[model samples]
Target: MSTPIFPIQQPASIAAAAAILRDGELVAIPTETVYGIAAAPRLQASELLLHRFYDADSWPALPLLLAPEVPLAHLARSNQWAERLRNYFWPGPLTVLLPAIADFPFALPTPCVAKRVPDYAPLWPLLRALGGVLIVGRAAHTGYPPAITAQEVAEQLADDVALILDGGRALFGLPSTVVDCIVSPPRIVQRGIISAPEIMAALQRPAERN
Candidate 1:
């Protein structure tokens, strides 16, 4: 099946992306860090489709892309460090590990959830259209290079994706930094765009504000 590719600037294209997602299909979207394959959070079929295409190691712990305005409490348990990290670096590429609220939809080996709010221009409208949260997974198959452009996404997963939203090449070809706030001191679990010292500073700066 040949998948459709759309420029994210088209209002109708964004609407189409949202529409297919509601029909339990997946869409490939550009993030500041990389292209991602995203699914609607509510539908059972969306979860099944995500797991069908992605495996534990390749797409481990599919993260939530949220609008910055989303209430943190609604998705994660409170942690002062997580809040501080978010306040400083959100609306950009920083994925924070937080304890999932009970009854959170995506079941993982652990109760921890990873969430991010990207600074990318192309995501906001579709994000709001999809209710401010999109379950995002790595766009490439296992052992493949990460997709940074809409064309790269289509090249690799054309049959699997519904629509590829082109927002040009990724702003950063690197991945988002992942911090494990599930632990005390909120250590840097995976280094990507944000530096360790910067994260450590953000974690400690909460004391300065107090």
Candidate 2:
């Protein structure tokens, strides 16, 4: 069960990666922040595979990366602040936690669903082609630094993952800034690349919590 590394520059490779995801297999995909193990969130088999291979803590309330056009209304109970912040910093390393609409077609753990749209160019086409919830997280165990390159991902995950999209090292080499927009005055759950002050400034309001 050797994991295969695919060059994202190749259209065939991208297609193959998408096929693997459609088949409910896990793929290590590159993002601006770090390499993430990506899988189809709706598939039970995929969920099981993700839970079994990824760390337990990593599975709970994991963020699902979506394309820019994936309607945020269905996915989040957003407010003016949340919407403004999303407008300002989406398609980047910012994960927003919003109140989940009941019976939303994803396997999100809590009443809130964490979602984001990465700025990575290589993944856009595959995301457009897949057209479904793709759950992703840093491709490493708990307490380890996030994997940045395909080789790092392969080293950490080994044969557990089905494929790795080699898009070279991550630009930030850091994790995404997690924000709990579910609350009034969005709170910064975890700060990574984006700072709280920056987020507050972008929101054109004061951050009550950090």
Candidate 3:
């Protein structure tokens, strides 16, 4: 089956994208870091589609990308430490791990849930409008190089995604740094655009004096 495509010219189109997403369909959406394959959070079918597109080893168990302002308590099982981290590094290029909720659609084996609040303001309306957990991650093509431009996304995932919001090349050509906050000493698993020292500084803030 051929995927649908949408050119993201303005905010209004996000509603259209959301409509598509609600139907368990795939959309190649733009973010500050990279284009991502996004689906409505509660829809298992949409999550499965995204997982298959990425060839993710664990289908349905995927990380979620959230709007920065979305209340952490609503979507995550937060503790003092998790709250501190969210307060510090959200709305930027950091993906933190926290405990998962039963409502979460993905099938992540890790006891913690990985979350990202990107810097794209335009994308926030869509995130807020979606109103549930959304499984989003870097939209890279299978077995090929990662995509930095919308054109690359279209070229690579043309056959998979129902919509492609071409907002041009990503400001950052790499994925965000993923840190496992579930552990006592948070560890950096995948280091991307954000550096290790910067993360350590954020984690070791005086407010988080634990």
Candidate 4:
């Protein structure tokens, strides 16, 4: 089947994309960091498809795209650091790591999950349409650089991805910074646009007032 590239400007296209997701198919979408192949993790079909598309290395901790409205406590175990980071740089590129609750959107091999609520304007309506959460992995094959444009995603994973939501080139064009709040004084698992120092400052700022 030919993968369709949908423009976010049209309401019809967004609706179609949502329907595809509702059917448990993969969709390649854009965020400030890069293009991603997203799946509705709770669906059995999506779970099978994701395990097939991504390799062992890339499968351990997948990114969960969350809508801003999603209750933080419902997704991950309550943690001060997760809340701090979310308030600091959410609706933007910053994956906050936390221990997953039993009902967390899908099954994860590990107890911790990396979650992000993209700040990009164009990705919101679709996310909102899908009930505020989707499982996403980089569109490119494991180990290859992430796809920064919709065409790049199409070229690399058209066969696997059902649709591509074109949102132009990624603004950051780099992987998101990840902070692991599963531990005290959250650890920086992967550094990208947001620096380690910046994250530390945000986490430390609250203590300074005491």
Candidate 5:
């Protein structure tokens, strides 16, 4: 099947994209950091997409996004540092790893799960429409850099994906900065636009690398 790239400028495209996700299809969304393939929180499908498209074996612990109204405590065991970071950089490109609550809906590979709130404007409407967790992953092959354009995502994974919400290009061509806040003195698992020093300053302590 040909992957359809919808220009998000049209008001109807957001609803169309939401429908695709609701139907359990992968939709490429343009976030500030990079293009991410998003879907409803289904474990098997998410794992398959990650393996077939991104060549990733990571699951359950895979990066996810809480619905706009969902509280962090519903999925994660939050701490003071997490609260501070979320208040400052949420709805942005910062992914915080926290210990998953025992009853976290999805089956995670580990006890921890990473999540982010993308600050991208066009994506908000679709995310809100979904009204639940959105399982998201970078739209790129295993060894390649994050996909920034819908065309790049199409070319990178061929027709593996179902739809691409083309919002032109991403603001930040890099991926999100990941912080493992589940541990004491939260540490940097992966660095991107947000620097290590900056994260440490926000936490009010030095970060030990994970």
Candidate 6:
């Protein structure tokens, strides 16, 4: 199936994009790290649809990516450890896992949820427009080589996602460093642009490899 594409420039276009998201459709928006596939929280079915369409076999079952400022309490039971991590390294390239909320959307089901907030300030209004919808999304570089340009997203995901907003290549050429915040003494699951030394200094602990 061919997917729709849109360029993000005027506010009206972004508003239209939000409407598409609310309707359970997919939109690829720009972020500092990479373009992302976004869907509204209510569109649980879209989550599965995205995975199947994109052939993203490595991702967890419940593939929704939350906005960084999204209240942790909304998705999991919070503790001091979770709070500390959130306070320091959010709105950047870091994904923290937490226990899933029972009433959480079921499109992707893992023991914990992977959440992030890309540091794209201009896109905040778009997120606000979506009203904290649980997005079944991923960096535009999901399957293909990492997208360093908007044209890359257009080339790779044009047929899979409903819309693609060309905000240009991300400053960080890599995906967020994923950390298992759900575990005690949080640990790194995947190392990306953020180096081990930086993460260790932030957490003030030695790296724990499983």
The whole-model lDDT of each prediction reads 0.82, 0.78, 0.71, 0.80, 0.77, 0.65
Estimated TM-score for each candidate: 0.92, 0.89, 0.85, 0.91, 0.88, 0.82
Clashes of each: 0, 0, 8, 1, 1, 4
Worst 10 residues of 5 by lDDT: 52-61
Scored against the true structure, residue 15 in model 6 reaches a CA lDDT of: 84
Worst 10 residues of 1 by lDDT: 52-61
Q: Who is ahead in TM-score, 3 or 5?
A: 5
Tell me which of candidates 1 and 5 scores higher on lDDT: 1
Task: lDDT for model 1, please.
Answer: 0.82
lDDT of 4 at 98: 78
Residue-by-residue lDDT tens digits, candidate 3, 146-175:
677778887777877778777777888788
Q: Write the per-residue lDDT of candidate 4 for residues 1-210, one digit (tens) a residue.
A: 678898877898789888988888888888989888888757575575567565546445656898888876756786888888877888888988777887765566677667998988777888889888887888787679999998998888898877888989999999999888888878887889899889998897663233
Which lDDT value does model 4 have at 170? 90
In model 5, the runs with Cα more than 4 Å from the true position are 53-60, 205-210
Candidates 4 and 6, the one with greater TM-score: 4
Instruction: Please write out the lDDT profile of model 2 over residues 126-153, one tens digit for every residue.
Output: 8887784577867886778879999998
Badly placed stretches (over 4 Å) of model 1 are: 57-60, 106-109, 207-210
Estimate candidate 6's RMSD in Å.
Answer: 4.5
Q: Give the winner by lDDT: 2 or 6.
A: 2
> Where does candidate 4 stray beyond 4 Å?
53-59, 207-210
Task: Give the better candidate number (1 or 6) by TM-score.
Answer: 1
lDDT by residue (tens digit), candidate 6, 127-167: 77866544645545445655655677677767666777767
Count residue pairs with overlapping backbones in model 3. Answer: 8
Tens-place lDDT digits, model 5, residues 166-199 = 9877898898889888788788888888988888
Largest lDDT belongs to which candidate? 1
